[model samples]
Target: MPHTIRVLVAKPGLDGHDRGAKIIARALRDAGMEVIYTGLQQTPSMIVEAAIQEDVDVIGLSILSGAHLTLLPHVTRLLAQERAEDILVIAGGIIPPADAQLLKEQHGIAEVFTPGSPMSEIVRYIEEHVRSAKDLELPATA
Candidate 1:
C-alpha cells in the first residue's frame, strides 16, 4: 500500500486564534491526508520536532500574530538545522503579500495562503506539491 501524505499544522508565537488552523486541518483530513495540529503558542523548535516525530510531508504554519516575518524564517531555519528541509513548508493567516514574497524568496516557504483563500485551493496545492515518501522510492527489482 502507498503511504499517505502527512502534514503538520502549527500555530507559532502568541497567536491565540486557531479557528483557521483547525479548519485547514479538517480540510486536509477530509482530502485524505493525515494532519497533526501543534496547538497554540508553539516555538520553532517545537514545530520542527513535531514534524520530525510525525514524519510529515508538509508543515503548514498559521501565524496571526504578525510574526510571520520572524517565526516563519525561524521554523525554516530549524528545519534546515534538523536536515528536515526537504519537507515542504506552507504558511497562512494575516500575512501580507510582501512578507509572503520574502517567505518564498528568502525563507523557501512553498506557499502562503492569506485570509479569503479557498480551502480547496490549499488542499489542491498540497496534493500537487507535496511528494509522499512512497512516491520517492524506487520500485523493487526482479
Candidate 2:
C-alpha cells in the first residue's frame, strides 16, 4: 500500500480560535491524508517538534492572531534548524495579500490560504506539493 500524506495542522501563539483548523483537518482526512491537529495556543517549537516526531509531509499553520509574520517564520526557521526543510509549510487564516507574498517569498512558506479559500484548492495544493513518505527516501528503519 502507498503511504498516506501526513499533515500537522497547528494553531500557534495566542490564537484561541480553532474552528478553521479543525475544518481543514477534517477536509484533509476526508481527502485520505492523515492529519495531526495541534490545538490552540501552540508555540513554534511545539509545532515543529510535533511535525518532526510525526514525520509529517506538511505543516499547516492556522494563525488568526495577527502574529503570522512572527510565528510563521519562526516555525519555518525551526524546521530548517532541525534539517527538516523538505517538509512543506502552509498557512491559513486572516493573512493579508502582501504579508502572504512575503511569507511565500522570504520565509519559504509553500502557500498561504486566505479565508474563503476553497477546501478543494487547499487539498489539491497539498496533493501537488507534499511528497509521500516513500518519496522521501527515508531509511527502512525509519
Candidate 3:
C-alpha cells in the first residue's frame, strides 16, 4: 500500500489569520494527504508536540504576524530535539525572499510558500519532496 503523507498545518504565535492555512489544509487533503490543522495562536512548542503526536510527514506553519524569526527556529529546534528531524518543515505568509533563504539555510526549512502561491503548487511540492525523502530512507528490495 502507498504510504499516506500526513501534514500538520499550524498557526504559530499571535497570528489570528488562519484562512490561508485552512485553505491549504483542505487542498492537501483533497490531494490525498492527511492534514491536521492545529488552529490559531499556537506556540512553537505546541506545534512541534502536535507534529510528533500526529507522526506527520510534513509541517506547514502559517505566520502572517512577522514572528517567523522566533517561531520557525524554535519549531525546528524542538523537532530536532525530539528526533523528528526527518519531518519536512514549510512555512507560508508574508515572507520575503531573503527570509525564505534564511529559513532554508538556518532553520532547516524545506519550503516557504509566500502569498499568491497556488494550492496545487504547494500540494505538488509536498508530494514530490516527501516521496523522494521516503524513497531515499528505504532500502531497495531484492
Top candidate by lDDT: 2
- TM of each candidate vs. truth: 0.91, 0.92, 0.93
Write one digit per residue (lDDT tens) for candidate 3, span 24-126: 9998888877899999999889999999999999999999998898899999999999999999999999988998999999889889999999987898788
**Best first by lDDT, ranked:** 2, 3, 1
Where is model 2 more than 4 Å wrong at Cα?
131-142
Give the range of the ten consecutive residues with the poorest summed lDDT in model 2: 133-142
Candidate 1, residues 54-87: lDDT per residue as tens digits? 8999999999999899999999999999899889
Could you tell me which residue pairs clash in candidate 1? none
Distance from true position, residue 48, model 3, in Å? Answer: 0.8
Tell me how far the alpha carbon of residue 1 in candidate 1 is from the true structure, in angstroms, after superposition: 2.3
Rate residue 119 of model 1 by lDDT.
Answer: 87
lDDT of 2 by residue, 71-139 (tens): 999999999999999899999999999999999999979899999999999998887675462363322
Q: Which ten residues in a row have the lowest lDDT in candidate 1?
A: 133-142
